[model samples]
Target: MAQERDVNPWVKMGLELGPVIAFFIGYNRWKDDVFTIAGTDYNGFVLVTAAFIPLMVASTLILWRLSGHLSRMQILTLVLVLVFGGLTVWLNDETFFKMKPTIIYAMFAAILGFGLMRGQSYMAALMGQVMPMQPEGWMILTRRMTWFFAALAVANEAIWRLMSTDAWVNFKTFGLPLALFAFFMLQGGLVRRFGLDNGKG
Candidate 1:
C-alpha cells in the first residue's frame, strides 16, 4: 500500500467520484439518442450504464496503480457496479442500475450486522490499520454505520421509486456524498471520546 503522503485527498475524491459524474453527464447528453448495442437498440440510460462500467473499471485501475492496493470496499463496489451495470445494458432495463445502490447498502448493512452478532467489529478490521481506536469505540461505530447503511438503502429505494430518473441521478451524485459528509462530521465527538492514544502522544 502507498503511504498516506502519496495520496492527495482531492485526487482521491476525484478518482472515486469521477465515474458517477461521468455517468450523469453522459446520460444527460445522450438522453435523446437511441444507440444500438448487441443487436438491440437501447435508450440513453442503457447507453450511460454501458459507459459507466468501463469508466468505473478504468478509475479503479488508476487508483490501484497509484495506491498499489485497492481497499476492500472499493473492490466490492466495483464488482457490484459491473454486475448491475452490465445487467442494465444487457437487459435494456434501468431497474438493475437503479437497484445497485440498494444492493450495495444492504450488503454493507448485512455484513456489519453479521459481524456484530459474532462479537466482531468489522469496521475496526476494515479501518483499524489506519485509525487506531478502542474496541468499544469500534463496536459503537460499527452499530451506527450498520444502521446508517440500512437507512441509505431504504432511502435509495424510495427516491428511485418516487422520483424521476434525473432526480435520482442527482441524488446519487450529490445528495449521497453530502449525507456521508454530514454523517462523518456528526461522529467526530464519538471518535474523540473513544479514540486510542498512540505512543506519539
Candidate 2:
C-alpha cells in the first residue's frame, strides 16, 4: 500500500473532494445532526461537514509539505471551497454547497474565454504537462473546452434550480462523473486532430 502514496496528485483531489461527498451523504442521511458535532455519536455526514475546514487545511499543508509545490489552479480551487464551504457548514444549508460546482465551472469558463480572447490557448498551457501540443493546437483545444465548461456550469444551475435536493445529490454522485467521462471521449478527437496521437504520441 506504500506505493499508493506516490500518486499524490490523485490523492490530493480525493482529499479536496472528500468533504463535498461527505456533505451529500450527511445532509441526506441526517440533516438534523449537522449541528451535533460535539458528541461521540456524531452523524457521519454532519461529522464530515464539521471537519471540512480543518481537513482542507490539513490536506493543503500536508500536500505542500510533501510536494513543496502547489499549482495556482489548485490554490484557487481550495480557496473557493473554503469560502463557499464555510458558508455551507455554518449556515446549515445546501445553497452554498449547491453553488460550488457552478462557481468552479464558471471560473473555468472565464479563464478559457479570457485565454481565447487573448489569442492564447489557455487549456493547452494548463494541460501541457501531459501532452506538449503546439500553441495553435492549445488554442483550438482551449476554445473548445471553454464552451464545454460553460455548458457544464449552465447545466449545474439548471439541475439545482429544477430538481429536488436528493436528485441533485444523486446527480453529483453519478451524473457529473459520467458526463465528464463522455466529455473526455469527445476531446479524444481533438488530441488526434492536433497531430499528437494520445494512443502513442
Candidate 1 weakest ten by summed lDDT: 192-201
Which TM-score value belongs to model 2? 0.76
The runs of at least 3 residues in candidate 2 whose Cα sits more than 4 Å from the true structure, single-residue gaps closed, are 1-13, 32-48, 195-201
Clashing pairs in 1: none
RMSD of 2: 5.1
Q: Write the per-residue lDDT of candidate 2 for residues 41-95, one digit (tens) a residue.
A: 5434434555666776777777776666666776887888688878866666557
Residue-wise lDDT of candidate 1 within 25-84, one digit each (tens)? Answer: 998999889987667899998888888899899999988887778878899999999999
What lDDT score is found at residue 132 in candidate 2? 71
TM-score against truth, every candidate = 0.92, 0.76
Name the regions of candidate 1 deviating beyond 4 angstroms. Answer: 1-5, 36-39, 198-201
lDDT accuracy of residue 113 in candidate 2 = 95
For candidate 1, the C-alpha RMSD (Å) to the true structure equals 2.4
| Predicted structure with the largest lDDT when compared to the true one | 1
